[model samples]
Target: MEIHKKFAHSILLLFVVLATSQYSCQAQNSPQDYVDAHNAARAQVQVGPIAWDDNVAAFAQSYANQRIGDCNLVHSGNKQYGENIAWGTDLTGQAAVDMWVSEKPNYDYSSNSCVGGSQCLHYTQVVWRNSVRLGCASVQCSNGSWFVTCNYDPPGNYIDQRPY
Candidate 1:
């Protein structure tokens, strides 16, 4: 029984090692690979194996240099998402210009009527269209290729944000 248990533990450890190595190899993209991914995204292509831009110092430097005058780049870290690259420093603000990658138009406008400046029931209006590349919003990271969705508006109404 003791020998059997030891053998099982060794197999498990080997499997773990193999799995970790494979994942790391796949996740580590070369600097050129990062540039290619960024270019594809600039051309409105959503390629997979998204580069999350975690500890890629070289990639970050190259991306910043490449998009110098094209975007207002910002490096930000999220506790849950780890280190990430963002565009338009205040891209979360109301006046921020973002890219809407959805296929249709999406609208969100809401107002609450005030009587004598008193608080009233809150009312909200949310509208959207159903189509490919319509109602979705996306923002490219400073890393160049990765995109995060900003579903607040459609593609046409907001500023044309791009990676270039």
Candidate 2:
């Protein structure tokens, strides 16, 4: 009886773990997921939180949908919006945002530049004070990789301006 109870408990625990992992993975790609990830990073630097815009999301979704064939990392060329893009196998929207936020260490707020010329534009854009809106999209490509993108309004990363 004791052995049976222990086996049942183990099976239950494993089931719970698997269920939780699956749900989290599925939840990582929504618009709210993207906004929450971005806001969390922005909050760390005392920057104001941004809101979601349907128009912006539509634009992002359209661009992401277009890349379903090749999953290439190309800018939308809108110039009206700031953009950050990422591509990887099994990439999720939250994962892409996390990857961008990982560049925080490379950014120098005092110097207003990336240290050693490392790529920190994505990080800077996430925390840009004047960028009051955000939209993001994730699409699975024909090659089995994922493409993710986030667009910011009023843009960021001006030639001589500080992000915050």
Candidate 3:
């Protein structure tokens, strides 16, 4: 009976080991090691916390000894969805200018009310599309992305202290 119990325990351990092999199939590491590595990677601030100016500076430096202008470029983080890449930094705040240059329209505005204010939490009325309707964004941080709830003002340009 003792020998039989030992044999069953050994088989169980072997199965556990084999079941975890997929996580470390790329390299010859154990499942515990992979979990540790994953935890370490999660300790960093997600994408949105990155400074755009720093990124611009580094990118510029790579080309020349140039400095990224400190025009308060969007302090957004990197990610799969939200990345406030300055589509165009033109002096003239023309709506059409941005629309023309952007391949992705610079942003994807959500449909919301503007009477009084907007339901958007963190959007800025950057420019006027028509009159009251303006561009806004709600900044957020996610996995390697700076997500801002972007949108325009058609229902009335501005966010009132109300939920829509």
Candidate 4:
């Protein structure tokens, strides 16, 4: 009898935890917002020689701060924006907010050159293209809010490929 009671209590606790987690996910988040956060975060964490999924959902929640629960993906305060990573497409905010290197084009892997020479270029392209199923968020309500800034490593482009 004692074992049965313990099992019941354990199950009850598990149920409560699941319910609370789901409620938390919905309370402060919308579907699009969740998708955005997951994608962006996945990119950031993915480059560190390790692949992670646990933090993806949490990373996607911040976009909820800018959106309303309406199905149209509009936000109550459209003044704010969310940015995503290169391979992310969950539509958290606008493409303008992303922390990408603007000087390079998004069409190819050259925009995001790889480390230790261009060997990673082809591989990066494949990975990037394959991971773009999330699609883009088509809104930029945070117009002119960001102070555009850029930094380039002068001596870094030591390769022989230059338009002379």
Which candidate leads the pack in lDDT? 2
Number of backbone-clashing residue pairs for each candidate, in the order shown: 8, 0, 16, 2
Alpha-carbon error at 57 in model 4, in Å?
Answer: 22
lDDT for predicted candidate 4 compared with the true structure: 0.33
* lDDT string, candidate 2, 114-143, tens digits: 999899999999999999998888888999
Provide the TM-score for each candidate, comma-separated. 0.25, 0.85, 0.18, 0.23
Candidate 3 is scored at a TM of 0.18
lDDT string, candidate 1, 76-143, tens digits: 22222212233443243111112322211222222213245542111100111210121112233454
Model 4 Cα lDDT, one tens digit per residue, 1-164: 99999999999999999998655533423335434543453355352111223233333334432332222333223112122322222322323223342322322334445444423321232223223333222222243121211111111222333211
The TM-score between candidate 4 and the true structure equals 0.23
Better of 3 and 4 by TM-score: 4
At residue 92, candidate 3 shows an lDDT of: 19
Off by over 4 Å in 1: 1-12, 15-26, 45-164
Residue-by-residue lDDT tens digits, candidate 3, 33-115: 32232222222212111111333333322322111333233533322122122222221122222322232222234533333
Q: Output the better candidate (2/3) by TM-score.
A: 2
Q: Could you give me the TM-score of model 2 versus the true structure?
A: 0.85
Residue 120 lDDT in candidate 4: 34
Residue runs of model 2 more than 4 Å from their true location after superposition: 1-24
Clashing pairs for model 2 are none
